[model samples]
Target: MASSEQHYILPRPEFDKPTKVLIVISPYYKAIADDLLSGARAELDAAGASHETVEVPGALEIPAAISIAYRQSNFDGFVALGCVVRGETTHYETVCNDSSRAITLLGLEGASIGNGILTVENLLQAEVRANPDKQNKGAGAAAAALHLIALSRKWGRSGREIGFQPEGIQIAGKAEGPTTA
Candidate 1:
């Protein structure tokens, strides 16, 4: 397949308030992981955002690590970085799909997360995508998280209310009573 020559870059988000981010990386491929981490850190630094990095065993663990950090830490956003190169076994598909789904679910739950996990057919493809001077998927993921965090702050709430509540717009906590005509 042919790749697009045009590169569309979005304006980097600027945060009014201080932003803290957590980066969860799976260091299965040390060299590739290092490149991804380097790119992500550079983006976070440029945005004037402080960040913490943690390593997981594999791509499947990246999401769980973020989830744990999300609950126990006070990070404003998260970046998940990893590389999953396809293997002869079906484990490749499982890792890619599960990790992605977990990240999406966390995002839907109001967590600002950027998925930097690369699913590639070979190590060469992964290297190209993870390279800082190449695709720089790592930096892209960090930017995604920052944008979401900015949007969340702009909206004043992280999540939306689903279904009608008996009292007020808040979804959390119990409603006092059901009032209907």
Candidate 2:
């Protein structure tokens, strides 16, 4: 047997360019949320992305706002940033579960929503994750959304392709034109 080593080649994908995005945040933990938003804003600014940051009452409102923003069709993606710290009551569980599920469903239903909600037992963990230099979750969420958007574009779907083109320029394989009767 011949001994040989093979090198792997990596391919770089082309991005769809900077686009408008929405960041829905919860005011539950204003301090931590501020940190998260700052991190996210830094990344967006660097990428020249047009974006809006909206504050909701809590994590529960994040998803609904996201859905509304998506329906409005003004943004290419969304960042769902929130923090839920467990307390003595059941409110924590409800917020965590509902917020997470809503975000998941939003992602599944042709929406590019990055789940950045931090459900932790205490404020320290949330701070660690949301802090600009500590966790950089804001940047992480933005990157995730951007990466997903690129993947969607590469797959020939933008989560809004529900019909054919008016000009009828069907994108076919190398074999060629559309066959018609």
Best by lDDT: 1
lDDT of each: 0.91, 0.79
In model 1, what lDDT does residue 53 have?
Answer: 94
> Mind giving the per-residue lDDT tens digits that candidate 1 earns over 1-181?
3134557889999978899999999999999999999999999999999999999899999999999998888999999999999999999999999999999999999899999999999999888888999888899999999999998898875455645556444344544455587
Q: Once all C-alphas are superposed, what RMSD does model 2 give against the true structure? A: 8.7
- Where's the lowest-lDDT run of ten residues in candidate 2? 1-10
Per-residue lDDT tens digits for candidate 2, residues 1-181, read: 1113343422322355667789899978889989989988887776667789899999999999999988876788899898999999999899999999998998998788778888888888888889898676877787667666666666754434455555545444322345577
How many angstroms is residue 81 displaced in model 1 relative to the true structure, after the best TM-score fit?
Answer: 0.3
For candidate 1, give the lDDT of residue 140: 92
Off by over 4 Å in 1: 1-4, 157-181
TM-score of each: 0.85, 0.78
Q: Count the backbone clashes (under 3 Å) in each candidate.
A: 0, 0
